[model samples]
Target: MLSPRAIAHKILLHIEQESGYPDRLLQSYLDRYDNLDPRDKGLITELVFGVLRWQGRLDSIISRFSSVKLKKINPVVRIILRTAIYQILFLDKIPARAAVNEAVKLARESQPDYVVRFVNAVLRRVSDNIESLKKVDKTNLTASGIAEIYSHPKWIVDAWVKELGTEETAELCRANNKTPPTSIRVNTLLTTSENLAEELRRAGIEVQPCKYAPDALEVKKGHFNLQRLEAYEKGLFQIQDEASQLVAHILTPRPEERILDACAGFGGKTSIFAQLMENSGEIMAVDLSPWKVATLEENLERLKIGIVGTLQTDVRKLNEMNIKPFDRIFLDAPCSGLGVLRRKPDIKWKRRPGDVYRLSLLQRDLLDSLASLLRVGGVLVYATCTLLNIENSEVIESFLQNHPEFCIEPISDTIPWMKVFARGPYFCSFPHRHGTDGFFAARLKRIK
Candidate 1:
């Protein structure tokens, strides 16, 4: 049996080499090491996510100790030190000596004896100065750039600095580094919220009802794999963010209304719409990739969704027959994913400043193509998992310029709880501000 640190090392290497998502990847790795106690499991998860979240800060510390530049260090050893130092600084329960010893053991797997010794020395240095590391002054944004130190791209920090002020930007960066809570959407079709709450209690799970969403629940304690829980396998609920759950309601599809969920990957919100319409509406879910749309189709079948019609086609182009116009539509446009950095930590490093401008261009093309399929006076809800102005408000502002028939509509009556929405009927959320994923959505009505 491999030690938990060795398993973590394997998982960390995969995260560095592959394009897989962290949650799924981490869960898969944990499935192999089933005997790990919940406490150890939690530690491994924290180390993995923390290293990804603060790679720059870890790298900066590594740079201070090693002759090699941060990236120039051996990938395996680098990840080991990162995992060790993360525990030393952030995790109070893991003793510094244990952290250093585990790191040395992990390094010995591939490196020679001398390389392991080097890792031990470097990590000891970090452990000795954990307090100073925690209190490092971040006042100078340029010299010791807070954004980079906090594992965020400098450009995003610049944008946040301009929009949220310097002090607020640093706070936002720090908040994003922390792991987001697990939010699950209860499947209303199978059971009511109250019934599911009772079911969760039966399973010995401590859960809290979502304040804003009637069907959402936040896991407070008792970390059980949701899949094995009878509530989940029986189609009782799904893990989805609160902000994402907002998208379906913002559209406010009526029973028997014709709607298209363009870019409906995995069908989480699409299933919500199916439930809301009480299986009485026609929903066409379109996505560019067949693989993603297929998963959605599978989910619809599993959840007994009768009203949803799945299709694999680009949202930028609709080629369905006898589909004149939809009463309501959602683009759920793909963008830089800046808003979801907490869940998708790699996105922060993967994204470039210019990606926003480029994605904004694609979003415009998608909006233009999809809006044409909406009937006059129809409601179109445009949404993204991105918080930047260029991708949200600015793009919507530009679109309204070209299409005068479409105008922003009041969303207060629709979503009463979300008071801090974007100006002019657009809904914008920040993780730090709304306790939800940073999201942006705009409601528009087409007037002929």
Candidate 2:
């Protein structure tokens, strides 16, 4: 029966100490405390995500207020300060006094008398100077300025500024800082989108038809567990982002086609492919992790999909499997996950500057290896939830230089509705512009 703030404190500590994903950890807590008030659950979610989203700015504020350096402070005490400061600065409904009081109380539980007083004094100072702390200079376009203002790493800001200019980079950072929508794809194999939307509304969840993807819905309102819904148990839909749903459509797998979902992690898009094919195709969903393969199989069963087979093998090792040429191949290669920051803000902190360059090389290798597995005239869609050019189009360019047999195929040619997402021959969706996760995909055809 921990209070919402206490639960948030624990979750944030786990994220800082164990590198746990906020969503999964929060969900686990909520699931265990099913009888907890929905509002309290919402607060817990808000505190954890808000604290992580604005960690950079929060740390800056801490440094300004505390005599002790930010790094020298105890980790637990730092989390207490962060949660209190987040609520004080961001939440209009929460009183600054209540935030400050709760932080002192939390600190007193484990900290010494001097430390508790120190926490109280720091929060009070922040509360008195709250206006100044909340005021952001949007006109500051310098890398360090944007990093501190938008709570992004300086290197990421530098990269975005170098590639996308200051204005768009600021917009991207703003979008990443905001909360992302909860989107799910209709399991057309089990129910129609219209019917599922109706069911969700009847059950008190407000949903809207997704703007681009024909089969996806955005949850406009609802705080309860989606997995507890009868529709979820019945497998009428699968939780997925609108942008991610578009990748399978870009691949456009046909009924009875032999498809290779290379680097398939948990099979969100693979399940959509099965639905589009009316559950008639053979989809070999491959991943390097055994846990992901097991999870994919479980999700496929829950979604009532029967056509996808799970394979626990790396894409680099697939050549030794003697697999026949496939009609379609989907390489949702791993990347820096920069585009999904809105949904997973921890990524902004977890990823290093070198990660983008390192992952781009892996993406290029995945594309090169999968190219030989696709039959002549077959299409292979390479996609990532990332905004960096070095990991997206540049990876494709590097692969094409060595593998002349494959050329970029316009995504719009296969799905004309996707033309709106097109950037040159590639499909690029931005969180700021598209209201979806930042995503990049390029469809390539084996020209023989």
Candidate 3:
């Protein structure tokens, strides 16, 4: 019986205090509160994600109005203020009075009378000055200004400014703030993209074929409960990004080839590999978490894909394992995950500048350990869902320096749509440019 604001506040509290992912936590709440109508569910999701996405800007506005430091304010009260402020500033459909009234109501339920008065005073002030409060000077392009304007952490803004330059970084930040379109890859093994698109349309879903990945479909409208759909039950598609689908295409696994998915978490690309090989190749999917390995196994069954074999082990130590050499090796190494900020806005707040350097080291170790597993003349596709130079190009450059036998392979010849994403020898996609998650991928071939 909890209101959407109440539910969002509870979820945000956990996300802030425990570093829990907002999507997972929100899904859990939706599942737990099965009685919540679709509208309430939508509101809960919007409030939680919206507040997290714009937390930096919201805090700036709060600092402008309140004497209290953001860190010193009670976490629950802070989230309440943010939710109200977001609606006031961004949501045109939501009347300012409704947003303020709801916050005051929620405040009364959780805090003392004085705290309720504080919430009322602050929200009323924000609502009254909402027009002026929304205007941020776009001409000021300082790192701190960019951070405030874009609602991204100062460190992330500064890093992007240095690597991507100010204008492009601002564009990236703006893209991250916008709601990302839902993209899914059709399981070509079960159905063709045309057939799947027709089926989804028949089911009242608006979908369009993705230009980059042949199998990708962009769902423009309609409910996306894939689990409840007959197509999903029959394993016709899996939710994946268009850019992510391109990673497997770069590998170009042939029938009956031996492949190693070195960092397969829940087997997104592993399943793609199976489909690419027409379910004839043997894919050894490995991940550090046993839970992920189990999930991958379940997905393999659900997709009716039998060629993939699962291994629960850290990819960094794969050199010590007695696994056989692979004709192709895929190292989807972990990075700062800055690229998918549109989907996971909380990461921008939680991630630190040092995390990128630490992850780059791990990425190097993964490549070095897994490179030996690739057969001479075989392919190795190094990829990350991040736009950072330290994690993408730098990692591959460092690996090539140490391993002379492996050389960068131009992705242009691998797929017909290469012109859309090929960045010299590397493949890169940006949210602002490609309308896909920002991703960087390199195809390397072993020469020795």
Candidate 4:
């Protein structure tokens, strides 16, 4: 069995070399070593995510200590130093000497003796100046300074500064770097939030009611495997962010209505639609990937929901099928995913400046295609877990400019309690402001 550091090294190397989500890759590796102790698993997770979260700052620090430029270093050696430096600077429990020793040992596996010695020299330098290097001047408001201090790409920092002043952007970056809370929505069909919270607490898991979403609970403290819990096996609740849970409330499908969950990824929101409709409505849950469709079917089955049907086809293809207009539609369109950085830090490194514009085009196409599928007077909620206006309001604005038949339905009037989260006609939640994943949702009504 690979040690936790070894496992982390492999996963981080894969992330650097390939195009895949860190969470998915980490889970696959952990599953292979299921015999690992829970503490070991936890450490593996911490090292992999911590290294990614602080990669930019780590590289900056490495540059200060290494004679070789960061780009010139061997890929594996770079990953080893990154993990060791992450543990040294971030993990208080880990001794700096142990971190440096483990890094040298990891380097010896594949690197030459010279490279191994190089790794030792750099980590030792980092340890020696650890206190001085750790001090990030918050007053340095330049984009590059904020980028290095917060470990975000400079382009992202610049964009955010333009949209939300520098101070707010810094706060947002700070929030994104921290660990996100584990929030779950109670499956009201099976049990109430109170009962589920009681059950979880009885299992020695401390949970508190979510401030906004009535059925959501934040796991304040717990160490047990959530999937192993009886409540989870029974599908009494789903692990969803409180911000995401609020999207279902925006849709608010009624009994016996026909709803279309466009771009439903494993039916996270589709299940909620079934619950709100009290299983009286028919939902055509569509996704582009066949595997995701299969998983959606399984998740619905686990939740004991039967009112929804799954389809595996590009959402744009749905127009070719002879389907009747629906009472409601929820298009959780794909975006750059900047909003959930705390949960998925790899996105900061993976996404580029142009990705937002590229995704906005697709969002527009999906919105236009789904608009024809909604009957006049029906509601369609377009949502994305991204903070970019290009993907959020700009797409909506361009659509409204072209599609005169549809008009923005103010979320404040539709869901008064959400007024605080609303920016005029749109509903948005900021990680820095609302303590939820950065989410944007716009309600539009098809009017003749």
User: What TM-score does each of the candidates earn?
Assistant: 0.95, 0.98, 0.97, 0.97
**lDDT of candidate 3 over 159-214, digit per residue (tens):** 88998899988898989998888888899888998999999888888899887787
For candidate 3, the lDDT comes to 0.88
| Top-lDDT candidate index | 4
**Which stretches of candidate 4 lie above 4 Å from their native place?**
none
Candidate 2 lDDT tens digits, 1-448: 7888999999999999999768989999999888998889989999999999999999999999999999999999999999999999999899999999888888888999999999999999999999988787777578788898989999999899998998888899999989999998899898998899899989999998999998889999974679889999899988999999987799988899999998889899999889889899799999999988998999899999999888898888888877899999999999999999988999999999888888988888888888789999999899999988999988989888999998888877767889999888899999999999999999989999
Q: Candidate order by TM-score, highest to lowest?
A: 2, 4, 3, 1
Off by over 4 Å in 3: 413-416
The candidate maximizing TM-score is 2
Query: What ranking emerges by lDDT with the best candidate at the front?
Result: 4, 2, 3, 1
Question: Per-residue lDDT of 1-448 in model 1, one digit per residue for the tens?
Answer: 8777777778888888886888888998788787888877876787778888887777778898876678777888888888888788777888999999888877887899988988988988888888888886666565237665677778888887877777777777877887788888888888888888888888888788876766899888765477778777788888899889976678888899999999998898899888889889799998888888988887787777899988887776574456779999988998999889899887887778888889999998888887678899899999999878888888889889999999987677566766665445778777887788888898999998
The Cα local distance difference test for each model comes to 0.82, 0.90, 0.88, 0.91
TM-score of 3: 0.97
Better of 1 and 3 by TM-score: 3
Off by over 4 Å in 2: none
- Tens digits of per-residue lDDT for model 4 on 1-448? 7779999999999989986878778888887888899899999989988898899999988889999999999889999999999999999899999999888988988888999889999999999999998777789588777898899999999999999988999999999988888898899899998899899999889999999998899999885357668889899989899999997789989989999999999799999999999988799999998888998999898899989988889999989999999999999998999999988898999998888888999999999999899999999999999998999999999999999999998999989999989897899899999999999999999997
